[model samples]
Structures are given as structure tokens and as C-alpha cells.
Target: MSASSITSQDLSIGQIFQNFYRVPDYQREYVWSESDAKGERGEEVEQFLKDILSEFEQATKDGAPEYFIGTIVVCPGEDSVFDLIDGQQRSTTSFLTLCALRDLLVELGETVPSTLAGQIAAQDTNWQGETRERMRLDLQYEDASGVLVEYGEGRGKNARREGTRSIRNLANAYDTIREFLSVQFPSDANGLRRFHGYFTNKVKLIRIETPNVSRALKIFETINDRGVGLDAMDLLKNLLFMKAKQSDFGKLKDVWKGVTQAIYDAREKPLRFLRYYLLATYDVDAKLQEEDIYDWLTRNEAQTGHGIDPIGFAERLRQSALAYQNYSRGRNPAGGADHGIYNTRLLGGSAVKTHYILLLSGRHLAPDLFERLTRQIEETMFVWLIAGVASKDYERVIVQAARNLRRATDAATFAKFEQEFLVHQKSLNMQMFRNALLRLHTYDLRKFRLRYLLAKLTRHFDVLAYGEAGRESLSHYMEAKNDIEHILAQGADDDAKLEFGEGADSFELIQRLGNLMLIEASLNRVINNRPYSEKIATYPSSQFLLARCQAAPLTIGVNDRITRAIQKLDPASSWDRSAIDRRQQWIADAALEIWGVPSPNPKATSEFEMLIPSPNP
Candidate 1:
């Protein structure tokens, strides 16, 4: 490890970029196009420019103090160039702002200050007397760098118009700065020049230059620990690159890139993925904290036998990331071939995060065994989530299951593992699940969770109606723009109040699970605040089982104890508290069967039946 030197000094933007800073190939592309004011990035381009100009505007009366922007971490690289380890986005935006201002100056026929132009583009001459035009801040992406160089050279008319995210963002930043300055100065060359002077001289950054990349990465991590921008995943990537051999660095980079892109594609947090990965791969016997991943890796170096094999670890990480991505989108990792779709549908959603570690670790199982395990895990999650089981206990069970799954070499072993760890657990048993369902009311649940439950029930009823499963899963319906509709309108008009008696208790009955149906948003809007008779008449148009049930009676049996309870009621009949109670009982009975809640012992059933309260109670 190289010794690092850290110092903080306020340097103007021009001085910082003029020192020939280069964003290396491994660095992330410019992502500061959006405003930090929107809670996306730090110090947006417009705000940054406005702040600098504000200081400049106040300079006449009070001689403005140096405006501190933020810190930038750089390391001395080969050939007198500095690799930007941090603050690339800020530095890149600053350069673009300067270029836009310089172009505006050129358009006004003012002498573009040589120093300003130098900061934009540096001219280098070799012994052959050939001059090469190099951008002061060379970005990793060629198209973006080209935009900066072309615009900086006063060729704004010929800059690249369309390209990658970085290119488009750079161009947008330039246009924004140019337009803002043009409006603020309004063709006044003197005001523009005065503003430029303040910008290049006043706006400051604490530049921390390091001796090497290793030291630079450490300093970068230290500085950004307090900020939301960087986390353990970013630092881990840097550490992996630092620890890997020079020859293996390229492969490590590619794998890390894939892992990041996969997680991004999945819309998952990188730190969360890393924590899950650690939990899945290592049998920690407890929840792995996000901040402790790197430390755990350091302490468990012997697990890999040799020093941490970045390539091997990265390959596993990528595979796990792919599994997570597939599970997130309700698609199987094995391309949804064979019975993989069943597993995908069974283990997809926000509630499945509890099962992610187990699924990820067992991703390599055979198709049949994998699907079986997925079903068990899904059952466990469904029971635990709906039953309101303690999250800590849920996590512990899943973690233990994951560890056992990792050790199981065959289908029989995995089956035993599931029976021992999940199926046989008291907290996840069918009876508890049944008891929980009996207590649930759609009105008491979150809108999304309620929708999910109703959607699943819809699917279950659909399978009974068709004698086969439907094409859409619970996740598919939830992901679609489906709205939870109250069968009894929330707000009844005068005629509706007359039809269905006007009482506060009647309104309260409308919120229960039996009165709810998942329907299209547009249809829900159309039926909004309508009478039950009018709403029931529209049910024939809906494709969902719950809605279709209102068209006619459909007796679909799940078992001897549970059957499809939804039935068409007379549209002209008054929908009162009794009606709501009947529907709630029907839905609860179906739910008990749907969630696989077991019945009490035969000997105790008569006593239990007497003790069990009715749905209304």
C-alpha cells in the first residue's frame, strides 16, 4: 500500500481543471444532469451557476468571500496526469459551464481570455513540433469528451448532438449555462466578462491530491462516508480492484461492471445486493449489516484459501445479481424455460426479499428441485408476511434455510432441509397462516398489499374456474395499473343513499375485504361513488374473477372445507351491513383455504367450531 497525503485547500475551478485531470476508463460516466435540488444529485448546474453569479453580484458592495463548492480527490498518475478518484461530476459540469460561457463570449466578439480557453483545452507540443489539442478534463466516454472539446474550441455549432447519456447530459449542461448567462447578461459583454471573472476566480473546491490510486480510493471513501452518494458497495469495488493482481484487474472490472449494471437493471440498491450476497454465500447465522460487508470480507480472507479471488467472487456476485434481477421482474434466471416461470411467479415481490438470500444461494439447483424449493420458500414468505410474524424471526428462518440449501447437494437433502427449517417451523405452519387470514381486512392493510392479496385470490379463483393457472401472476397484476375498487361506493349520493340506507355504519362496512375488488383504474374511476346496483351491472365487463363473479354464480371448489364463495346479488337489492358480513365470511373462508391454513384436529373440531367467532364478530 502506498502512503497517502491528504490536504484541503480552496482552489478555483479553473486552477483545478488546468492541472490536467483525467477521468479514468473505470470511473462512472457523468450523472449530474439532474438537479440536486430534486434530491438526485449534489449542487445542480443551474443552482451552482446562480450561486456563483450571486456571489459575483454581491462583490461590488462587499468584496465576496470565496464560495466553497466541495471537495475533489485526485491521484498523481503517469505522465504528469491526475486521475480523478472523486468529484468527477462536479469537475465535468464546471468545465462544461466554462465552455458555454467562453462560447457566449466568442459570439459577442469579445476576446476570449486565453486563460479561460486554456482551462477548456490544453495545447501540447511534442519534439516533432506537432501540436495536439487535448481537453483539460478528459472524460472516459469519447463522445462526451468530444462535445466538451468542440464546444470549448468555439465550435459550438458542430458539437455532437446525440449520443450516450453522458454526451446528451454534457450538451444539455452547456445549453443550460449558455441560456442562463445570456438571459442574466442580456447581450451586455461587460456583465458577462465580469461574471466570468468571478466564476473562474471565486468558486472554490478543496482539492485532495494523493500519491497513488490505492491511497486515493481510501481518501475518497473517507470523505464520502458522510454523504448519501457513496456507500460500502462503491468502496468494495475500489478495494477489489486494489487487491486484485494487475493481470486480473481487467476481468475484475468487467465483472464488477456487470454486477452493477445488473443491480441497476433490477432497480435494486447495490449495498442491499451486497448484503444479501454476503448473507447467502456465508453462513453468518445473523443478519448482515450493510456497513460490515467489507470488514467481514477482511476477517474471512481464509475462506477463499488464497487471498480474496476477485474474479471468482465477482463471478458469483454476477450470477447472484442475475438471479435477483430475474426474481425482481418475476422472470426465472434460467430464461423461464421448463417450469422456471412457476418459480418466478411464486417468489416475486417486495415480500420476497426475505427469501432472496435462500433463492440466490440455491440458484444452481436442478429445475425440478429449484421449483420445489421456490414453492416452499414462497409458502413460507406468504404465511409469514400475511400472518404478521416477527421480521427478525422471518429473517433468521430464511437465513438458516439459505445456509442449509447451500450445503444440500441433492433434491432429497434439500427436501429434508425445507421440512426441517421451513415447513416444520411453528411460525410458518398452515394453522397460524389460517388464523392470520381470519383476522385480516383489506381496509386495515396497505393499498398495495391489499391489491396483491386480491390479485392472488383472483388468480386462485381463475384456476378453479378454468381448471388451470392463468397467464398473469400476482406480481403482474400488481405491477399493472390496477386500482382497488370498493364494491359499495365510498360516497353515496341522495338517490344512492335512498337506495342503500344512509348510515355511517354502512359506510364502515364498505371498507372490508369482501367489498373490495381489483379492477382497471379507468373503470374504477368510472364507477367511483356510484350505487352498488350500477357497479354490479358494470362487473360483467371486468376480466378478473372477483368482478366476473358478480355477473353470475360460479361454484368452484378448492376442497371439502373451502369453496368459491363469491355470488351475484340482485342489483336492485339494498347493500347493507348484513350483505357486507356475508361477503366477508365468504372471502375469509376462501382465504383460509387459499393460504393453506390447516384445520384443527377432528376430535377438537366440534369444540373449536363453537369457539370460532363469526366474520361479523
Candidate 2:
């Protein structure tokens, strides 16, 4: 590191706002959360204001006549401009204080002067210097995007969206400060004059000069340190820089950056950055363990599988990112593509769960079968999608499902699950699948790596999942109650009986897909009310449900296609043309390895079990 001394004058809220100081183009967007620093903005703001107010109150009580809220930073900056590296928050709050003062003065019918210290109310002769000059009535301000904008009656107009917009909750802090200002100065002309004296004459801003941008950037990083936190983009950015050829790096970076920027700019926060990252890079299949995926990201364990060199992995990421970008932009690869990952929020709903479901559907089964399973899983978990979910439990299910599949004893066990899945219909299978995942997620989130849990909790997935208001509610809920009920319960009046207790009369009333469909819903109401075998045999809608699922998209992997198809066939009836066609094609395709011959030749039948497990066995 090169050493150079840069001098910049301490600047006030007015100065910073006048220039609209922003994170530099090269700087990462604001990734800090107070929680990341082990602090709460509400508590921090409350204490900060209380301290300032206490100082002011004591100063007045002591009859010292005056005190000001002022602080100076000695750091680096460019010639005439300096970054507010040290005092951004304080400076912002103070500016807000001034705004509140301006609002109050206007309400009070004061004849304000058109200059600093005199803008809201006339400046006193006692306050005649830099504060006076800087606080002038017509001071313009900058925005978070570093755009120089005018600030007059509409200072809040067209404010650029950035990460700190959420911190605007601190506006409550401004409201409190304003109330104190109003209380300190009485309403009468003489008393109001006293208030003006305290505000204009008592509020002083000090300036320190700084000399270079680089030094200022470092100093800013130090004083307002948001030390190492998991920024998903950082890894991707590093990968792009390190792996992309000099020739393609710029284009690749631009594409990746553009996608992230579009998300953040549209969403107006950095959380979307994380959302896009997961959608673009994270792929989870039933055969892949969640812990394995997490390990892939953090420990580079899974990345080592398939002998995937860093260069090769980076190439794949680049391809995937490009594919995602195209899908995001509505450009089809061959005419159609899946943007389900990008469009679905990660919250309580099973988008991530569905992702794994779909992944497994595709990975273990052929593309056609995978699509079918995906549709079934989605329709079954429709309620989860609509009701929204608490995230911790949501991820637990996601990770565990992958873990379970990765541990499968052999293709047969995997085939058995697939056979059961098709026999029962995708909806019923998915309901059970999600229940399994939820149980796992709950266990994993609490007991797994604390570091990973923390990162998962802090991730940007929520921005897409819960959204702003929902995010707030979720935070409040988490802070207040550590757990969220995964199952939506039946109303008290419901008469249906259940294993645990009285259940909802209708599936609509139940939340858990497992409880609602497989056991409790009207579709399975008879089954749950009766014995399992009787219900499966006599249920009026069972065959219709399976037929409907068969028509839907296939979502299992290439390997599972034969198994899925065979599971759908009737052992007693003459094999239909579709089944025969599928069997014939299966034999010809090189993709089918577990079974060489697809026909019912005795040898083929024996070998078929290797590829497709019996639903009963």
C-alpha cells in the first residue's frame, strides 16, 4: 500500500447533501446491517439522539448559553471534494434535523432569510462564520446516486434508491428531534425567537480538509467499517476477475453487473443482489445434499467433485449467469426458458424447495419426466406459495431433501421413491416431500453451522421472498418469536378428525401440504378418514389425479424417466401404445444404462427393476 497524506475540512450535513456523496462506482453497494455490527439502528439512533439532547439540555440548564452538534474528520479526498467516510450517518441525521427545523419554521410563520443560519429563521449576529455561510437558505443537495440535485421545497423528490433507504426508519429519530426543538422554543414571538437563537446560533458545523479519493476511501472503510460479511457477489466478482480471460472479462462483468444492477435498481436495495446470485448460481437436486451445496459455496468441497477445476467451474458459472440474464431479459435460448428461480421469492413458499424438487426431477429423471414431476410438486404446494413461509424452516426442508437423496442406498431406493411419487400423484408426493424438507430445514438451521445459519439468515433471499413490509414483519417476528408455525391450522369449528387432533373439514383450511392433501384435504378426506389401503383403492379421484399429473410437465432427471413411465403403467391391462413407445425408445437411447433392453423380454424385466423400483417394494 502506498502512503500519502490527504487533508479535507470537516464538512456539515449541508455540504455532504449538497454534493450527494455516494459509494464510488467501483465500491460495492452498502452491504452492512446494524446486526452485522451487532447493533440495532433503533437502539443506536435512540441512544445517539438521547446523548445529543442530554448535552443540549444540560448546556441550557448550566446557562452556558450555547453548544453545537459538530464533529470533524481528518482524512483523504480529491482536490475540492471529500468523501464523508467517517460521518455519513451522523451527517445525514443532522441534515434531517435541519430539514425538520425548516419544516417547523415554515409552519410557525417565521420570516426566514435566504441564507445559511438564516434560511429557516434569521441568523443572530452572535453566529457569524462558516456555519452561517454553509447553512444558507438556498443550499442544494446531492443524492445517493452521486447526482448533484437541487434541494429546496422538494429535497425528498426523486431520491435515488440505494441500500440505506430502509434506514429511513430513522426518520422517526428526526421526528423526535423535531419535537424537542418545538418544545425548547415556545410558540410566542419572543419564545420562538429564543428557539431560533438556539437552533441557528447553537448548531455549528466544523470542516476538515482531505486531499485524495483513494486515501479517503480507505479511511471511510476504516471509520465506518463493515468488516467481512458474506457478500455473495464478492465471490462471483472475484471469480469473474480471476477466471475470465482478459478478452472476455469486461463483457462478462458487464453482463453480470447489469443483471445485478437491474435487480437492485428495480428493487432499490442490495438484498436483491443476493437473490440474483442464488438464482443464477445455486442449483440443488434431490441427489445433492444441502450441506453439500453449502459446502460447495463456502468450503469448495462439492466444487471439487467431477474434478471441476476452478477455471471449468468459472466457465459454467459464466454460462449459467449468461443464460439467467437472457431469461431475465425475456430472451429465449431456443424459444423458451425457465425464469422460475428469478421470479419466485424465497420466503415461506417452497420456491427453493420447488427448485430442489425440480432439480431432482430433472437430474434423476429425463427432461420430460422431470417437467411432469415439477408440475405436480408445484400444484400440490400451491397453498405454501400463496400463504408465504418463514424462511428458516423453508431452507431446512430444501437442504435436507437434497441430503436425503444424496444418501440414497442405490438407484432402486431412489426409484422406489419415484414410483411411490407417481403412484400417489405429484401433488400428494410433493405435499409429503415438502413436509419432509420442513422437518429437515428446522433441524439444520438451528443445529448446523452457526456461521452458515447466520449467513443464510442475513442473505438477500428475503428481499425477493418477503419483500419490504413482509421483511419488516418477519424481522419483528423473528426478534419476538424464534419460530413460525409451518402448518396453517384448521379452524376450531372443523369436525374432521386427525391423528394429532381435530382437523380442518376442508384442505383449504389446512396449510401444510402433507396435512392438507395426503391426509386432510377433501381430495384425501376419505382416505384420512378411512384406512390408507382402502382410501387408495376406493378414492374416486385417484386415477383422475394421476392422469392429470401425467399430462403435466415432467420434472424428474434423465435417469428416472423410464422408472417414472413404468410406474405409470398398469400391470393387469394390455400395455398401451404410449407405454410401448416409451419402452421401445428407452432401449434405443444411450441415456438408459441400468436397463439395456426396454421390452418385456424376461431379461429386460429383471434388469428394469434396477432402473425403476416397484411402487410396492
Candidate 3:
């Protein structure tokens, strides 16, 4: 459960630490919205400053409190070095405070250690580094971005602005301290001198040294909970440190950053991105618990397995993902389209359930027919729900059905085979695909319908038809225009309407086909601005007229014909239970022909058994 603690070491603030605090690419990106920073601290900071001022009077009367100003945590390393897990904020703030003090000290003609103020101003080292070139007179702190921007800029936008204001406040605090020192310590140099003495001697940093990575991580978490929140990248970096093999860590870390950055910048959820990567790389779902994920990565299992080398695995995974993405883009130079949308969704490590099914379908059916079937299955409202919700299970059943369909297509009597295959079955095989399809069908379209309708209305009413032609010419106007909702919902266009209809919300806007389409360019653009209400206003009347125009002799209902066919297929049992009767009769007809068996009564055991193909004489 635990590893022995490694040696503990201390790292000075001046060291230029390279590759020491590097974040893995698989980690979540820095995402601090403006509201987060000032939301809580706005009041607390004001109180703290007032308390500090109040304490100043008491401090002068009662002497300073027994405690130092702040605390920093230092986790020791093997050779007198330490990783700055928590306390980057305090350290960086202190560094800036010292820089300002040092600058003020020089202006007061005070002696410092060999241009000490210059070291703080240098950009090469991010304070955590030890080298002279990377050295800073102030403590270095890295934000989520892991870039060495100045402390003021390192935090999120609001924090950056707040930090600058805090510095100005500090300057004023020092100004007060300068006057205080002048009266209290008459010979003292200035406020800078007073601030330096107060911090260098009065400040105390609580250092904890743990040899084990797990305990270190636990400590990291505990400390972060106390106001120093670690970014996702910070946690992921710690994980990679424990998970990655020494040799592969370098390259894999680079690849991890590349992969994660792309996903993060594109606004993907961390868990979803991780799941997608794992599925693509190892053909595995993120079904395992968090502990199991840690164990798998760190080789902390009973086998004493060295965990998967995150870097190497990540590099290989990146290559795989890139290949998959390139392929998914349907832009392969091989002069072929992407196998199918199904293949794109089911990209995985195993051929059994991956794009191989697409290959099987392409080999057996014409591309146009296959594409039609694909669009029918995947583009339906019901199927898309399965994809969006239960993707893995959906993929499994879809692949299975595609496999079965492919097998059936190669059989004799292609039309009957197709018809039989399309017929709903009461068996588990049929139920699974049916369930997947139904999930999409009953999906809530209320979220998306109005957004689409509104966008279309805007394009037709606000821009195209209304702008130049006006309402009178709307009937004659026609133009190549795209679906407003579809383009906006898919994030394709800028003309999307924010408000679609009354009582329609964002979720409802997501489900409609009108919200999902792009107007083709070849169509007329003159009618693009016409309102959908007006455009389709004549359809009902036209349909009424068409009923008269296309009147023909009456024909028997198809269900009656199907019932007659069913009676011929099964004569012994009385037809009842509409579902069973319909399905059983269809099965009897298809199976009898496929297996060379004679049909029997609907209620007879022979009729039911004959529905499934017989294993051979």
C-alpha cells in the first residue's frame, strides 16, 4: 500500500529548476474564470488588510505577534533539493514583495548583495530554478499554464489584475511602515529595510518531508484544500511522476501536453478526453475506479508491476489518436472516404468491435446503399441519443448488428434476406439493437428545436428575404441558404439566433433536424430570408388540391394483405396477441423458406421453433 520514503532535501529559492515541475500533457488545462477570484476574496482581503492595520497599532504597543507572516511547504528531494508542491502563491508573493523592497532599498542608498534587485527582474528562471542565470531574488511560482509569466500575470485574468492592485496596496503598507520605522527605529534605513527585516527573520515556512509519492500526494491535496488549490495539470503532473517510467517520461510528457492542450483548448471535459484517449489507445473504457486507474498507471498492483510508462504510452497513444483523427476527418489521400460514421464512433484497439465492421459492410453492399443505411441508423434522433449517452454499449450492439447484417447480405435471395433482417425480432439479439435505437428516438428534442427554428426564421425573416425583397416578394424569393439551427447548434455558423421561440430553451434547440442542417450553395438565395411560416403556409392548401388532382382507385390496406399472408404461413393456431401473431407469422414464412421447413399453426411449437433457422437435417 505504501513505498518507503525517499531521502529529503532542501532547494533554495534561487535554483533554476528545469523539468522539475513540468506538467503532463494529459492533464486538464488552466481554466480560471474571472468570477472565481474576486467572488470570495473581495471581502476577505479587505478584512485582512484592515486587521493588519489594526494589528499595527497593537504591534507597536504590544510588540509583534509570536508568529511569522505566512507559511511555505517544502518537500525534500534526494540531494538537498525539494519540490515546491504547495506554497507557490505565498512564495511568489513574497518574492514580489521583496523585489519591491529591494528596489526601494537601493533608492534609499542601502547596501544589498551584489545587484540583488537585478536578479529578481530577470526572466530566464522561474524562481523555482537554482542556476544563477535562472536565479531570482524573489520566489518563483508557476500557474496552471506552467509558463513563467510574472507573478502578477501568472494567475487568471482577475487574479492578475487583483495582484497588481495588491502590489500597489503593499507599496502603501510599506509607506506606512517607513513612517513607523522612522519614529520607532530612528536610525533604520527606510520602509524597505523594515519590511526586509520583518520577513527574513519574522516569517516561518512549515516544511514537510515525505519519502513516499502517495503520502506526498496526500499532503499536496491537504495543503491545496487550505486555499492553495492545485490545478488539474498539477495533480496530473504528480501522477505522471509516479506513473511514468524513467526512460520514457521525457518524450511521453511532451506528447501528453500536446494531446491535452488540443483537447483543453477545444473545451472538452477532462474525463471525456481521458476516456476517449484510453478507448483509442488500449481499446479500454475508463470503467475502472479511480484507485484502479492509479494502480494501473503506477504498477502499484500486487504483481509489483512497474506502472505503464505514461510518457511512452502517451506518445504511442498520441500517434494513434492523430492517425484516428486524420482518418476520421475523411481526408485520407488514399482516394477513399472514411469507412463510415459507425467506424468513426467505434474507433478502438480491437478489430472485433472496431471499424472492421465497416469494412465488412463496404465489401458486401454498394457504397450508396450502405451510406443510406448508415445515415438511417446513426442520424436518427433515437440513435444519436444512444451515441451521446451510452456510447460504449451502443457501439457494441451496433457493431454486432452490422456484423449480422453483413453476414445476411452474402446469403442467397438478397431481397428476402434484407427484408427478414429488417423485421423486428423478439429475441435478445433484436431487443438490444432495438433498445439502442429507441434510446435515440425518445431523446428530449425540446432542448434544441426552438434554437433551430429561430435561427431559420432570423435568416429568412431578418436577413435574406426581408432585407432586399420585403414580405410581398417573399413568395418569389428563393436562395441557397443553410439551416440556422443546424449550423449554430453544430457550431458551424455565426448567424444562429440566440432566442428561437417562446418557452424554448437551449436544450430544446438541440433536437430538431432544421437546427441541424446547412443550406446547400446550389439552391436559390433569394428565398433564404423568407419566414418558414410563410414559406410553408401554402403547403396544406396545395396538399388539399393535390388530393383531388391525384385521386385514384382505392387499394386494400397493406396490413390486411400482411394478415392474409400470415394466415397462409400458420394455419393451425388462431391468430391473437397482435405482436406475437405478426412476428410469429413473419418468422414462419422467412425461416420455412430459409430452412426448407413447412409452416405450422401459429400457436404450435413447430411454428415458433421454425422462426429461427434450423441447424441442418
Query: Which candidate gets the maximum TM-score versus the true structure?
Result: 1
Model 2, 1-617: lDDT tens digits are: 22565544443333434432322233233222232222343454445455555545555544534444444443333322334434444555555555555556666787543443334222223323332222222211112332112122324323333334333333344545556666755454444444444444555555443454434434443332222222344443443333445455445544555544444333322333233334323443323332233334544436333123444554454443443334333222222433223222222221243343224323334434433433334332322332233334333344434344333345556565443332233222233323332322223332212122222222222332224443332223223222221122333222223422423343432332222111113343333444222333433343222211222322455555433553442221112223333422322231112111122222212111112111210
Q: Note each model's CA RMSD in angstroms.
A: 6.6, 15.7, 15.9
Q: Encode model 1's per-residue lDDT on 1-617: one tens digit a residue.
A: 14745666678976786778788767666655532323343336778788877777778655766788888898887556788988887788788888877878788889988888888888777667888878788776443555566766777656775765567666667767777888999888888777777888888998988877777777876776633456677666666766777677667767877787688667777788888877888767465677676667667767632255777877778888988888776556765742233433443345457567777888778877877776666655655666556666667656766777888878788777765665555222445555555556655566656766777677666666555444434555665677877766667565555666645236456677766777877778877877777776766677766675553544555442224334322222446666666666666667656654444433321100111222221
How high is the CA lDDT of each candidate model? Answer: 0.67, 0.36, 0.35
The superposed Cα distance between candidate 1 and the true structure at residue 249, in angstroms, equals: 3.3
- What ranges in model 3 sit over 4 Å off? 1-134, 137-205, 209-240, 243-249, 279-309, 320-377, 380-617
Poorest 10 consecutive residues by lDDT, candidate 3 = 542-551
TM-score, per-candidate, Cα-based: 0.76, 0.40, 0.40
How many residue pairs collide in each prediction? Answer: 0, 50, 49
